[model samples]
Structures are given as structure tokens and as C-alpha cells.
Target chain A: MERIPILRMGDFLLVTIQVDMHDELAMTLQDDLSDRISKTSARGVLIDISALDMVDSFIGRMIGTISGLSRIMDAQTVVVGMQPAVAITLVELGLTLPGVITALNVERGMSLLRERVQSE
Target chain B: MNVLRSGTQAVRIEQDVVLARQTARKLAVEAGLRLVDQTKLVTAASELARNTVVYGRGGDMDWEILEEERRKGLRLTFRDQGPGIADMKLAMTDGWTSGGGLGLGLTGAKRLVDDFSVESAPGQGTRVMICKWT
Candidate 1:
């Protein structure tokens, strides 16, 4: 997996994760992100999952959990760029994560997060 | 006419995960559950089936269709004569996964249904029961 930190237009810290949506790796990634978000106290987190073609039940649940943990740590999380098939599979598996937000692209996700941060 | 149809079947699969899911899905539908309820039932069954093959060294799933006061539902029990879970608490915790299982297997399955229970001992084997209402 490749993780890169980027600075957005509105002072939002964007972390992009590029990797296969496997179970073990996804959990590990979540752990790392959660730790980093807690330590940095970032305003928002943007996860770019565009490269992932498929997300099984386990990975989907982890994403949901990560979003919740981020909120607890005082950071909002936005999942960006999910494939259509992966989205369908997650819904079919009956895995509905309540608080996490999704976006069709990274720019939109970052925009939403920026707006959220500004409003809050 | 009987309100509920119940039966038990056992199969041994070396590493066939798809077959296990198919069997569970079929049983859930045949038991007169709604589509959404069937999805939850099958999802839970898939998790147990994978565990049976991966951690249990093989096992069987027992199921029954239940009816009461015009309400219908399905109950499934998965039993395996393999090494049982040593730490039930840790196993149920979020993000605590063994055997490379995503760690959501037990918890997610539990949330999908209306009722859930687990019985296991170190060497006595493990049994998981879950039920979903239609």
C-alpha cells in the first residue's frame, strides 16, 4: 500500500491509501490511520480507495469502524472513490456503517470535509 | 400443514467456500424468510462456514425453520470438532482477528440477526447459534 500526505486548498490534511482491499491489510491500515489521526488531531481525513475493485464484508466493516474511531478522536473521515461492484457487494452483505460518509471522487470528498470543518 | 419445516444436513468440504454459502442461502430462503432476513441469515452462515473449514478442520451446520403466531424465522447452529476459541472475549472484540479472519466474523454476524449465542471449550469443540426473523 502507498500512503501519501497531501495539502489541500482549504488547509485539510488528505491521506491517500492505495492498495488491494484485503482483510488483514485493511485492518492494519485502519489501525495506523486511527493512530495518526488521534495523534495529529487533524480536522478531517480523506481516504482514496479508488484503486480497490472489491471490498468484502470484513474490509467494509473496518472502514465503518475507522470512521467511528476518527470521530471519537475529533476527526471526520470521508471515503472516496468506491467502485460500483464493491459498493453493491457491501450493501448485499448487509454491512451498513452508520456515520461514515462516501464520495464519488477525491476532490468532492475533500470539498465536503473542508465544508464540514469550516461549519463546525 | 406444519407451520415450520426443519431438517439437518452435513457435508465435508476441503476448501470449498462458495458451496457452503450457497447451501446456507438456499436453506435460509426455503425456511420462508424474507429477502432481507435471508441475506442476514446467509451472511452469518458464510462466516461460520469459513471458520469451520479454516479453523475447525471441518464441521456441520444445523438449521430449523420456526413459526409462532403467524411469524416465521430461521435458526442455524454451526458445530465444529476442531480447536475451540481459547479467548471468547478477545475473539468478540472489534479488530481482534485470528487465522487472518477480518475479525468481524462473529460480531458482524451477531449484529445481522435478531438473536445470537456461542458455546465453546478448549478441546470440546465450538457451537454457534444465530436466528433471524422474517
Candidate 2:
């Protein structure tokens, strides 16, 4: 089975998406991430999608769901490294990802998560 | 349809949706469409393909590379023989969902393309067609 790696980075869990995501894969990631969050009790989650060429409504909703789920578990979630074309396509797809935080890149995303971790 | 090249793929299985999206992207790129345009077309394809599998109970996704004088475009058509939607108006409305989704699939796909059309009947099937020009 193809699975995305989740690395522990201090109090944060980092997920770097390096391939195109299909429906089942996205669902699997959501399940895996949620379980890991409970086990590690991480303070934050950062998803890097720089390698993703597109973000459809399904993937967009998956991102939103992951962030929402993390928030309910007392973890901050920030998606980063979205390409310009993806950003445009997502907006046009009517997936604003309300309540989900976003950043320019992984570095900025970490700092954003750190701020949340510090405040909490 | 003024199609220069056309092909059809089955959308019965989940993996077929991914192939549909790839076909749309490749056709857009080969047509020399812009990056943003390619992404938009691919995104639209993904939504429609998923709908065909999940809501339409599996269907067919067809693609065509189009040419009209100097204009070049890619067109995709999704058709299914499942229980068709009764209310087209409600279905097209954002946030109106019958499949536990964000209710953005049909409406969102429409926004990502240059030309869009939908046809359905209660007992008959449903068909959605979209075109993106370069």
C-alpha cells in the first residue's frame, strides 16, 4: 500500500505530500494522520503540498477535514507550499477552505504552527 | 462537436476517476493551454468523474481535443445511467449535496471551465459536458 510518511518534528507532525493524491489515498492519509495525532499528542500538524500540481474539490475538502479534525484534538493545522496554479484552481473550484490555516511554504508553516503551539 | 481527437474511458471503478483526470490534464497540456488552464480543466475533470462513480453509479468519461480556426480547446463529457437527479436547480446550487460532500462538485466544476452544460431526466441518466479553451 502506498502511504505518506509522517515525521515527528518536535511538538509538530510534518506531512510532505510528494505525489498526486487519489480518492482512496486521501482518505487513508486522513485516517492515518488522525490516529497518529492521538498517539503522539502532537500540538500541531503541517502539510506540505509543493509537489501537488492540482487541488480538486475532493482533495480540498480532505484538507479542510484534516484541519478541522486536528483542531478538535487541540492541534493547529497549517497547509503550505501550494503552487500558484493550484491556488487559483482551488478558489475557482469554490473550496475556500474556511477555518483551515495556510502558509506560503513549509518554513513559514512551521513558524505559524510554532506560534500556535506557544500560545497553547 | 468539432472534435480533432476523441477517446472514452469507463468510470465504473474509483481508480478510473484518476485516469479521467490524467487524460484531461494531458489533453490540456498537449493543446498548449496555460498552466492555470490545465489545472482548472483537471480539477473539473476530477469532480465530474467522482460524481459519475459515487452518485451516478458508475459511467463514462469522454475527452476530445478541439480546434476551431485559430482557437484550440479540450472538452470532456461525463455520463452515467444511475438514478438521475430530480431537481437540477437544487443540484446546481452550492452547498446542496445528496452525497455527503461539501456540495461543491457540480457547481465548482462549472466555474473551472469556459463552457458547461448538464442534462438529466428522472428515470434516465445524467450527462455533464465542459470545455476549456486555450
Candidate 3:
């Protein structure tokens, strides 16, 4: 199994998640990311899901949970590069994420974060 | 007239998802649905099958092929005797999840198919009916 990688980009953190994104791994990633955000005091987070081929209910919920927790930790989150098919499937499953903003690509997501940091 | 096909197999809750995906793929091919349509059916079935094993304590999936004139579709019913959901509305919320999921399973599954219905009660288990047209 490939472990999720977290990298630092200026004040923001970029977490690259590549997996099937199902039950236990999803939950663990959420908890771990939330904890890291608090500890590192990152201003923003970019979650890269471009490599994920499959996502189930549990994984969807975990992503929502992470977004919620990131807010509490005073960090903004951007979901980057979601596959079109995956996005459609998630929408059909009624998993619309309210607070988390999704970007068409990682560059756009990073740019959004830069704007956020500059405004603050 | 209804063309009924039944499959029962002993499988772990984790593996049930695989079975669901396989069944959906087979049905989609047999029905000659487009690749996009096939993917939608597979994704919906994946969510429901995960629910059967994870939340419903494992169960069975029954698929029925329906044809009317030039139209063809497939209906999948998932029956499980697990602890039922007490609150349907809350469970439908995007961020509301008992487990660590993104809580999109039920809602996402609903979006993939043309018709969807879910029935559940506390201590009574759950039944989910979904259909997709080619």
C-alpha cells in the first residue's frame, strides 16, 4: 500500500493521497491530516486526489470530516484535480461537500490558496 | 413480465463491494449500456454493497432485468439484516456519517441511477432498490 505523502509549500501543506480511498485508510488519513494541520499551523491545505481511481462512501465521509476539522483548526482546504467520473459518481451519491472548495487543477488550487494567504 | 436473476454467496463485508461491482458490470454489458452508463451503475452498486456489509452486517443483492419495447434497464435490490439507520435525514447529509466516511455513500448512490429508494428502521435492517436505464 502506498502511504499518503505530505509536502510543505510555503505556509500551506500539500497532501498527495493515492489509494482506492475506502474504509479504514480514509479514516486514518483524515485523522492524521487534521492532527498535522494543528501541529504544523499551516494556513491552507491542498488535497490531491488525481491518482485515485475509486472512492466509496466511507472515504467520502472522511474527506468531509477532514474539511470540517481543518476549519476548526483555522485552516482552509482545497480539493484538487478530481476525476470527472469520480466527481459525477460522488454527486450522484449525494456527497456534495459544502465548505470545501474543489479546483479544476492543482495549479488553480494552489493559486487560490496564495490569494487566501495574501488577503490574510 | 420480470426477468429475475438471484445470486447468493457467502462473503465478508469487505468483499461484498467487489461482488456488487462485478454484478453491475456484467448487467451493464448484457444490457448494452454505454460505458458511462455502465460506470454509473457500477458506482451506485459499490456504495450499496458497501452499506450492506459495513452497516447492514452483510446480506444479498438481487438484480432484475426489465425491458419495455425498445427500452432496457436493470434493477438491483440490496437486502440486509443489520442494525438499521435510526435517522434517514441525518444519514443523507453530506457530512453526517456514523463511520469515518465522507457520508456520500447513500446520496452518491442515489445520483447514479435513474430510480432509487431506501427503506430502513431501527433494529429492522435495510432494503435499497436502485435502477438504471440503458
Each model's lDDT: 0.71, 0.92, 0.77
Residue range B1-134, candidate 1, lDDT tens digits = 23366666563463344455566677777767765566566667767766777788888877777886776778878888988999999988865778765676787678777889999989988899998776
Model with the higher DockQ, candidate 2 or 3: 2
| TM score of chain A per candidate | 0.84, 0.98, 0.90
lDDT of 2 by residue, A1-120 (tens): 999999998889999998778889999999999999999999999999999988888889899999999999999999999999999989888888899999999899999999888887
What does the lDDT read for residue B49 in candidate 2? 93
Q: Rank the candidates by TM-score, best first.
A: 2, 3, 1
Interface root mean square deviation per prediction: 6.2, 0.8, 2.8
Candidate 1 structure quality by residue, lDDT tens digits, A1-81 = 533344343344565656443334566677777767766668788878787644546557777888898888888889999
Separate DockQ for every predicted complex: 0.06, 0.86, 0.32
Could you tell me the TM-score of chain A in candidate 1? 0.84
Pairs in steric clash, model 2: none
Predicted candidate 3 versus true structure: per-residue lDDT over B1-104, tens digit per residue: 45645455432467557667776778877877776777778888888888788888888888877786777888888888889999999987665678755566
Better of 2 and 3 by TM-score: 2
- Give candidate 2 misplaced runs (Cα > 4 Å): none
Q: Residue B108's C-alpha lDDT in candidate 1?
A: 67
